[model samples]
Target: MSEEELNARHAEKMKKKKAARDKILATKTIEKGLLIVHTGKGKGKSTAAFGLVFRALGNGLKVGVVQFVKGKWETGERKILEHFPEQVTMTAMGDGFTWETQDRQRDIEAAKAAWERAKAMIMDEEHQMVLLDEMNIVLRYDYLDIADVIEFLKTKPADKHVIVTGRNAKDELIELADLVTEMEMVKHPFRAGVKAQKGIEF
Candidate 1:
């Protein structure tokens, strides 16, 4: 085809695409809090949730974060977010991973304590966004009662958004979530014997 013909054809196709996108956009008028789940074996689950925290803060929104399984080490995000103490509430509640703790009872206790903090954040009207980091792992191990968690989630205020991140999310939670993203692992450096580098893994 000639260059002029190609340009005209592309313009017509783009015009149609824009019209369809606009139509769809026009139909989306509903607005409410979302129950967002980020789970899977891949990396970046908590990273993605923290990105939303930054976006929310940028919009003058208050965010509450409770770390369930990553409390042993210091993270760069935590340090930066601490600077915005007025808008961000971050609590590192876990004692570390299950393997590191090596005690089922200790893990359970930690999970329970973390859940108490998370529940308070969920119910606090001051927080617009609450990130429950690594919550899925606790759920997978049955640390907290799923039914109780569901009840509180369903009763949260209409304008409070909740983000739960970790791997191996339960099916019940997935069913109740408004948006669920399962990150599929295509490749990872850990499998190649590469230890986690600073500012990337944390």
Candidate 2:
């Protein structure tokens, strides 16, 4: 074919592709949000959870965040959430980190309290989104009651959306969710003996 004819054919293909994409986009549903669970041993579960919080905030949704096993240590997400006190309701369990907990019973109590707090926030019809940060781990560790948690979540208003983030989420929780995302660790800076960087992996 001549060069001009080839260019014309390319332009035609592009136009057809664009038109097809536009048609598909128009039919897409405005999602009613979801009951989402993020689980796996990957490093970014917490970050991914908060990323959704920021998205909800941008869309003018009220969000509730309850961190189950980590508090008293400064992290980028906490600082950002702190700035949006009105839009975001965050309650840290004050357990710091599981490994740092000197008393197991105390740790469990702290986590249980946070779980209860999260349940109440999620049950409230006014709360649009609930980010149960690391609550899955608490459930896995038996620090919180899975049955109670599930009941509370299931009873929430239909328009409410919940996001659970942690490593090792139970199969029951996964089954309960409308959407599930597993973040597998293919590679991580920590594996290379490098410390976690601020903002990116804090």
Candidate 3:
């Protein structure tokens, strides 16, 4: 085909694509909060959740964050969010990972306390988005009752968005979530003897 003919064909194809996309978008009228879950044996689960928090902040929405693990370490996101106290309420409640603590009972207590704070944030009218960082890790260990957590989440305020991130998400939680993402790790630097670095890992 001539160059002019090729240009015309491409334009026609894009026009049809745009029309189809618009039609589908018009049918999606319902707007409400979402129960979003990020889980898998891969990196970037928590990173993705933090990205949503930043997006919410950009839109002038209030956010609440409860970190169930990595509380002892000072993370870059935590430091940045601290500057927006009026729009963000963050609590890092974990003592550290389970192996670091080495006490099952202590881990359970910490999980319980973090859940209490998380529940409060979910119910609080001021917050529009609440991020439950590493919640699945605690759930995987049975540190908190899954039944209770699911029930509470079911009854959360209709206009509030809840985000849970960590590996090994429970079957029940995945079933109840409105949106779920699983990260598949094809490669990672840790396997190549590169330790977790600032800004990249944390």
Error of 3 at 18 (Å): 0.4
Q: What is the lDDT of residue 158 in candidate 2?
A: 79
Question: How close to the true structure is residue 114 of candidate 2, measured as C-alpha lDDT?
Answer: 86
Q: Give the TM-score of candidate 3.
A: 0.95
Candidate that would win on TM-score: 3
Which of candidates 2 and 3 reaches a greater lDDT?
3
TM-score of each: 0.95, 0.85, 0.95
| Tens digits of lDDT, candidate 2, 1-202 | 9999999999999999999999999998677658899988877677777888999888888999887867544477777777777898878897575788778888888887887798788778778999888888788888877887787777777788889998899988998899898899898777679875666666
What clash pairs does model 3 have?
A: none
The sequence of per-residue lDDT tens digits that candidate 1 reaches over residues 4-75 is: 999999999999999999999999999999999999998789888989999999899999999888753447
Show the lowest summed lDDT stretch of 10 residues, model 3.
Answer: 70-79
- Predicted candidate 3 versus true structure: per-residue lDDT over 63-150, tens digit per residue: 9999898654446887888878899998876668788888888889989999999999999899999999999999989999999999
Residue 87, model 3: Cα distance from true site in angstroms: 0.6
Ranking by lDDT: 3, 1, 2
Ordering by TM-score? 3, 1, 2
Instruction: Rate residue 20 of model 1 by lDDT.
Output: 100
Candidate 1 has a TM-score of: 0.95
On lDDT, the candidate that comes out on top is 3
